[model samples]
Target: MIETVIVVLHLLVAIGLVGLVLMQQGKGAETGASFGSGASGTVFGSQGSGTFLSRLTAILATIFFLTSLGLAYYASHKASAVQEAGLPDPMLQIEQAAPEAPVSEDVPVIEEDFTPASAGEDVPAAPE
Candidate 1:
């Protein structure tokens, strides 16, 4: 449950960080604001928006980093818990459960004929 909460907070903070970064104006945007582009009439006021958005972005980034660490800790903890449970690994269980091939006694075996050939037998000659 705590891990779930941390994961949700991490996602929310990540999205908020992206939105805050997108909302902030670039350095060159000041040229447009000076020429009556009306950027100065924002809800947070002219200079206020810059500092407020930057600070909020920083806070969200910190939260995102912390939640990432929390999630990693939970993952490692769960892995360790599984190890402590003394359960056999699934792969080993699968190999142990497989049936071995059956041996058959009906198949005929070839035997070598060690009898000497008669003197009149026609044997192929070896290559010279």
Candidate 2:
């Protein structure tokens, strides 16, 4: 339920943001082209207190933040949800064959004489 609501809100914001942006003129647009104001100083402020698109953008941005928070909150608490409701260990239902023992190839072995008995034998009993 929570996820659905968040997704809906997210989608709505995405669409609305696009539409709102398209409806507003670009920054370089001529002020006098449409309203003939020619960038004149306004009573509201230098550039006007705020244009409709700017205000709408602010509102949509706030909604986007709220929906994002809602989604995060919902995700954090979703551990209690089960993949399948009222089902017990559905994965155990499938039967799997037993694993086979691995076989190894035979290899020849080489041995080396490391003892020191032959070393002193060559001395021929210095004090026998």
Candidate 3:
């Protein structure tokens, strides 16, 4: 149950990170700044959306990394527990059996038995 929660959280953070990173503007976007774009001086100051979005992206990325490590640790621990319990692992043990050959052509094939009607009985003639 806990593992499931962690996995879900990890996926969500990963998706959010992708979206945040894509939403952010590239550094070259500031080329418009030299042309005196009004957006350079926003109420949030010069840094504006760049710093806020980058911070959020970083936080989500960190969470994604942590969750990935946690999931790996959990999987390893679970596997070790199964081993410690002395339960047989089917994947670790497999035996191959010998294959048998098909029927050889040298063997005789038998046909079904059938008997024809006797000719001694009065036979009816076909109408012309």
Candidate 4:
């Protein structure tokens, strides 16, 4: 459940990050002369980033980075000691009861004389 929550959070952060990046206006809203324009001076200043969308984009990007680092750390450290996920061992199964002891010393084992076929030697016989 915790892993599910973390995965959901990671997905939301990724979507938000992509949306924020796509919604941001590029450095040049319009193409002026090829040479460096005066407008370039104000691009990185407080004026450009003061916009609400820019602020939100920055915040969401930070969250995306934080979650990415956190997930990496969790995968490396927290998951190392986790147990193998599988069905319970058959020897410890509780549904069946223990077997009884052998009843007679002279009882012949029915399959004692039979030998198992070799891997490549056996071609199964079809039905009669």
Candidate 5:
């Protein structure tokens, strides 16, 4: 349950980080805003959305990293727990379950003639 929650939070933080990055203006965008492009009219005030979005993005990134670590921990622990449980390995189970072929003494044997070809035999010519 806790792992599931962490996974969900990680996904939400990742999405939010992407959105925040996309929403923030690049350095070149400031030139247009300076010439009355109306960036000052944004909800974050006259300084524009830079500081607010940047801070939010940083926070989300931190959360994303933490959740990643948490997920890794959970995975490692789960693997260890499975090992401790003494469960049969999947490959071993498959090998054990396979049926062995029967050894029959009455099997038919194929015989082949090994005589060398005669010079008069009709051999196909090799393509040039």
Candidate 6:
């Protein structure tokens, strides 16, 4: 239950991070030729957008890292628990259960003989 919540939270954070990063303008966007109307008078103030968005992004990134680590730890712990129960790995059991292919040696082969029959005699024409 807790793992599910963590996974959902991680996904939301990842989506929000992508949106925030996309909304922020690149450094090259400040040039007059890019926006055509200039970048002055924005919602986040003159220079505040970069500082605020960058900080928020950093926080989200940290959370993402933590959740990732937690997921890895949980997965490894579960795998070890499974091993301790003495249950054979499904993949190994599948490989062992598969039967080997049987060899076949009874097939008949045909060969063509190309020698001409009665080489010195004239052949008779068949009636139509």
lDDT string, candidate 6, 24-96, tens digits: 7798766753556544666776564888989999999999999999888888987898899998988889999
Would you estimate the TM-scores of all the predictions?
Answer: 0.65, 0.48, 0.65, 0.44, 0.67, 0.72
Please tell me which model should have the higher TM-score, number 1 or number 6: 6
- Please report the candidate that would top TM-score against the real structure: 6
- Cα deviation of 80, candidate 2, in Å: 6.6
lDDT of 5 by residue, 1-128 (tens): 99989999999999989988998888888788767778656787888777888899899999999999999999999888878999876778899899799899899999999999987798887799
What do the candidate models score in CA lDDT, each in turn?
0.84, 0.71, 0.85, 0.69, 0.87, 0.83
Tens digit of per-residue lDDT, candidate 2, span 1-128: 66897899899998998888777767566555467764446554546434867898989989998898888877755533543354543455453344456665675577997877667576675675
> Which residue ranges in model 6 land beyond 4 Å of their true spot?
33-40, 107-128
Candidate 5 local accuracy as lDDT?
A: 0.87
RMSD of 2: 13.8
Error of 5 at 69 (Å): 0.2
Of the pair 3 and 4, which is ahead by TM-score?
3
Residue-level error in angstroms, candidate 5, position 123? 21
lDDT of 4 by residue, 24-97 (tens): 76767545525555544665553454377778877887887877777787777544544254545455565455
Clashing pairs in 4: none
Instruction: Give the distance in Å from residue 87's predicted Cα in candidate 1 to where it truly belongs.
Output: 2.3
Q: What lDDT, from 0 to 1, does candidate 4 have?
A: 0.69
Candidate 4 to truth, TM:
0.44
Model 3 over residues 60-98: C-alpha lDDT tens digits? 988998999999999999999999999877565543243
Q: Sorted on TM-score, highest at the top, how do the candidates line up? A: 6, 5, 3, 1, 2, 4
What's the number of clashes in each of the models? 0, 0, 0, 0, 0, 0
Ranking by lDDT: 5, 3, 1, 6, 2, 4
